[model samples]
Target: MRIRSVVDVKTSLGESPVWDVEQQRLYWVDSMDGRVFRAAADGTGLETWDVRRKIGSLALTANGDGAVVALDDGLYRFDFAADRVELLAAPEKDVPSNRLNDGKADSRGRFVVGSMDTLEASPSGRLYRLDPDGSLHVLDDGITCSNGPCWSPDESTFYFADTWTGDIWAYDYDIATGNATNRRVFATVDTADGGACDGMTVDADGFLWQAHVYGGKIHRYAPDGTLDRTLDMPVRKVTSVMFGGVDLDVLFVTSMARPPLPRFPEDGPQRGALFAVDGLGVHGLPAHRFGA
Candidate 1:
């Protein structure tokens, strides 16, 4: 019920927000700045790496030595010790105008990611799934700006958002085969109210909590896509959310400090800082690590 900024670091376009329960650390990305960050649950022991390319998302590897990241060009293996990346796959080599955007690992440990048209002028982006064995499969397409990829508690439903269209879609997910099908609209953000759905996480109770970028709020939706409630935020560009802390009860949120457009106004001083919501009386599922 109480929201407070937990980190002293601010980012240009903060996103992702992944929590590693085993290590008791939180990892996040500053997309526009192409930076990856790690810190303890209390915001101590902070470390950062400049990947030199726009990074869309990050997923922890089971071995804890490296991470799998969605860079502007493709999926790469990020080595924490060496601070370098090795290309894993570039599914969109032909689509030079598009870049990988939002992604997360399924409960089965396969990474699911979506690309976006950098210009936001065409549906040139596509969704991809990277299996642990190093095979990449295209699942969906016709996306302009991709964001918010997560799954339900039962692992039956996969959720993703196309920021340009303001629609969040749900898919019939096959945990065994790592397939996503039966795509349908799960929810839509009324941009007239001033933002698109950016990132999301499902609570332990199966409710979807989404960050409304530019609207400065988080929307909680029931399993059937009914709006359960909304929590206003102090910053306008709330980018993503995750659950962390000792018991995984705290809701960790990331935001953006950069202005939306070239000449647009900037947000408050706390815009790109990481914030934690405590006392929600709810917990969340642990983030799945890359199986390989």
Candidate 2:
């Protein structure tokens, strides 16, 4: 498969690339710019949704009416038709240093989100599960940059990433009780750059695909945590990946332009761009949003 640039988003911190199967559109957020974008399946007809603050991630509801967004300060229900947003609840209001980051809906439609320090400071982040009925559950704690709470196809396993630690951990997932057990290291990255795993997705074949921030590539792993394939990217900071297209053969990747110390040239071609790769035959399940 060959990687090609689909569009130049110019997002300072592009993250959470999700495919809306029903609408045949791709949705994503510019976390630092506080912008949400939607484009046709072919990367055309792009439209921007301006939000009040940085949006971490978004999920379509079970009924496909609208989306539930994890904003910088709290959770909100977004009415796409009305273009309005209503606050649900703030799980981390007391922790002023932290902000909502990666999140997605579970198999049962419950939204799970993680919080991390905006300034990349101490390891005070935590993962929370927000049920449809508004009950909140703390799943894990003491993380610096929480990312990628992706689940297996059967909902029997969960994969989470602590970006600061450069470790991806796996857990035995119980969908019925919403409990995670057997925490073990699934993958680990080098300490030189501390390049950690970011957003991830499970394919129809049960393999996990993860984007590596500062690692300059996306790694595909077998179910048993063995390396499958690696797709090299021009950008240094890849944030997320998702499978889209009618047959789910196309892989969509989102990247950020910034690096830690010396940044890339402003005119570089690969930074903040949406990319696509063909020939991958793994299909992804539709995302479920919070109900109204």
Candidate 3:
């Protein structure tokens, strides 16, 4: 496979990467900078928006008019044309130490997001679902840092990660009611392989692609939770992954540029830049839009 950095811009703490097939654009966030960005598949015609608060993730609206974003303490709707951000819900308003982290939209258009303890020391974070009706529901709890929220192709299984704990979970998902149940450990990140699991996406063939934050690698896992293969990246802070391109056959990755951690201080010069991996002989499922 061929790998290369796609964007000139870098981020302090880049996290989520969402691909919009209709617009042929990629949307992502620099969590620490509270900035949202979009660009063409090849990184041209870039645009950015500042929400003035830490943004964990964002999802395209079904109508393509705006995005539903997980910013700091709550979920908000951002209107691209009007340049306005309206709060949708603050389910954790009472928990000052937590902030919404990774999230994605389900096939039914419900946004599934999770929270993280700011200090990454406690299990105060929780998983939440924001339905299209503007109602919020709690799905799971006892998490320290949340990441890698996605689903299988058939929409029967939900996958999520608790980064601080080095675990990825699989849950039985109900497409009709947007509920995640029967939670169980689907996989765990070997500290030797990576510092932690950050973000993930499932491919068209049902294999899961995971980003190894400190390991500088992207791993593919079979449907049965077995390691299928691993692809090395140039950067050590690989944060997230997605699929985008004219034919949805390219893999887009996001990374971080912040000061190195004590445990894993080494990093590539291209850290914090966006990357594209092509010619993998694999395609991805269509991205789900919020309220679609």
Candidate 4:
């Protein structure tokens, strides 16, 4: 499928493309700048909210009241109407050297986020799950960088990627309990191929679409871990992807820009821009929201 720029925004780190189905808008984050962006399907009505700290990720609340966001230390509740952000938890308050990274809400409505060393010095990252009642649970540890995290359309599989390890892992997910087990490697790609998987989403037919940060492309893989197709992008640092638009048939993508150097020196000015892939003949399931 051909991916073309839908939004002119070029962020230092653009990630987390989530569709607000009811509002008919797209929400995403610029991680390095701690900015949350919202825009209509046609790319107009673009508005930005700067939280003044590095924001890792965010999920819409089930009631559509606000969002639960992962900043430097922990999760917070961001009320768009009031322009307020209240702390939900500071799980890593003691680890000032670490910062939260990619996160998403599970089918059970729990926010699952991961952490990474800010300096990229050691493999000290960790994965956490924030429940509806504001309790945080540590699911795994010792990750260098956390990136992709998405549940299968059937809610039976959980997938995550450790960017530094160049491996994507899958788990047998218990949707009712928010438990992940039977952890196994699902796919592996070298840095030379992509520099690791960044973010992902599953299609209605059970295929996974993954963004490749270093490769300037998006890879579509069957649930069995076989590559089905690839969509070449104009930028190298493709960060995340989600299906949006009226029928959930448009694939919305985000990317990151490399300072001083154009992220897509060969491809010209489309680097770090948001994209929309249409006419792919596939739709996606709705994103799950945080219960609280």
Give candidate 1's whole-model lDDT. 0.89
Q: Model 1, 1-292: lDDT tens per residue?
A: 8999988577988999999887899999999899999999889899999999999999988775788999988899999999889999989888898889899998777999999998777999999999999999999998998888889999999999888687789999999999999999998777886677889999999999999988899889999998898998889889899989989899999998885467434688898999999988989889998874
Q: What is the overall TM-score of model 3 with all chains considered together?
A: 0.97
- Candidate 2 residue-wise lDDT, 232-289, digit = tens: 7877778899888887778888887654235322325688898888876567766555
Question: How do the residues 1-292 of candidate 3 rate in per-residue lDDT, one tens digit apiece?
Answer: 8998989577988878999888899999999899999999889999998898999999988975899999997999999888789999998899998999999999889999999998888999999999998999999999998999999999999999999677789999999999899999998777776467989999999999999888888989999998899998998889999998988999999999884335556576898899999999999988898998
TM of each candidate vs. truth = 0.97, 0.93, 0.97, 0.94
Worst 10 residues of 2 by lDDT: 258-267
The local lDDT score (0 to 100) that residue 22 gets in candidate 1 is: 79
**Residue-level error in angstroms, candidate 1, position 23:** 0.8
Which candidate, 3 or 4, would have the higher lDDT against the true structure?
3
Worst 10 residues of 1 by lDDT: 258-267
Count of clashing pairs, candidate 1 = 0
**Residue 1 accuracy (lDDT) in model 4:** 59
Lowest lDDT 10-residue stretch of candidate 3 = 259-268
Candidate 4 achieves a global lDDT of 0.85
lDDT of each: 0.89, 0.82, 0.90, 0.85
